[model samples]
Target: MSSAVVGLLIQELPKGGMMMTRTLILGIAATIVAAPSGAFADTPAGNQQAQNTSDAREIVCRRMPPPAGTRIGPRNICRTQAEWDLLQQQNREEVERQQDASHYSRGN
Candidate 1:
């Protein structure tokens, strides 16, 4: 689904409850699938819009850790694909920088 539509649905969900939310979500999904491939456009703007839609639909989730080896309820942390990718790249760069600093300190 497109980000704008999804945002609208999210805003309506609080008042509509689960049944209405589910119905709307399903309808939107159906519409997106049934629409023509060129429904977005052939231009760069359209391509960017399509990419944004795909990114909006992409979700990354990871379970939160339990405390001190005790079995606790599962908690998930989620982010979009773009967000996850940026975070991963930042972490890799930080690690490499640290390694470089360590090597420099060791006179290597």
Candidate 2:
């Protein structure tokens, strides 16, 4: 029954559509095949602290708005969680430094 429906759908699609459908199916199959190995990876009960540290080093991603300019899409930035924290701190310090420089220049 399901095979008949799939056959009908495939017959209706254009030539490129079959390739796209196959690619999608293969991607899903790969994900399902790979998921369980990660779930069952050897993690020692006593290594909770190590796990937490690794979590902090895990890759995090953000989509930042394009810089003030002509037409362009948002940029994707990826960094470790710790790196992101350091970046935020550095930016904050830079802003403060600029503010102090401006204040001093104003003779206040």
Candidate 3:
């Protein structure tokens, strides 16, 4: 049923209903109200992990100068922690590769 009807029923439950019935209706109503919008799988552990991972997906952000001719002010750049770490690793590897190439070319 609709949320409005469930809400009205909950409001009216305390007036004259038995305590057990009221609790049952309240529990059902709460389940309906708190249900997640999307379909859920039966994997409880996986669901909790996924929920925690999504919740932890905050980004590391910085204000950097805009690219040439784009703007005069700084722009915000953001990346997830994992992405930032991977980017740093790749940059280090590239720098090392360039250094190795330079050393070889210099006959060292």
Candidate 4:
């Protein structure tokens, strides 16, 4: 190939990388959406270290699981285990994963 073509290829490097990243991301997303989050679905520990995470997942039994992906402001409220139980067994109880910055976004 000519030098010009080689330079063009180098210029396109990031673009190709972005495309591959996007594809990998989309594939993982699809897998997450299609498969059950059974790995995270273990029963809530009565007093485990991950109480918060357990509280969130336990809501599945009485309340509802958090929504898929990130839930922003004005989301649902799930208080009791009974309510969690009423939640769909699938993934209805997935609370939005809050970053440090977004902690208060849930109308806490």
Per-model TM against the reference: 0.41, 0.48, 0.40, 0.21
Q: Which ten residues in a row have the lowest lDDT in candidate 4?
A: 89-98
lDDT of 1 at 81: 84
**Ranking 3 against 4 by TM-score, winner:** 3
Sorted by TM-score, highest first, which candidate order results? 2, 1, 3, 4
Q: In candidate 2, which residue pairs get closer than 3 Å at backbone N, Cα or C atoms, i.e. clash?
A: none
- RMSD in Å for all candidates: 15.2, 10.9, 10.8, 20.1
Candidates ranked by lDDT, best first?
A: 2, 1, 3, 4
Off-target runs (Cα >4 Å) in candidate 2 are 1-52, 106-108
How accurate locally is residue 96 in candidate 2, as Cα lDDT from 0 to 100?
99
Write one digit per residue (lDDT tens) for candidate 1, span 28-77. Answer: 77788778766755668778899887986699898877677677877888
State in Å the error of residue 25, model 4: 0.2
For model 3, how does the per-residue alpha-carbon lDDT over 1-108 read when each residue is reduced to its tens digit? 477876677677656656777678778877876686445635688788887677557688978887789757898889886677778899999999998888765454
The per-prediction tally of clashing pairs is 0, 0, 0, 19
Top model number, lDDT: 2
lDDT (Cα, tens digit) per residue for candidate 2, span 1-108:
244555666577778678898666556666777888898887787797788789889999999998788589898999999899899999999999998888765454
Query: How does candidate 3 fare on TM-score?
Result: 0.40
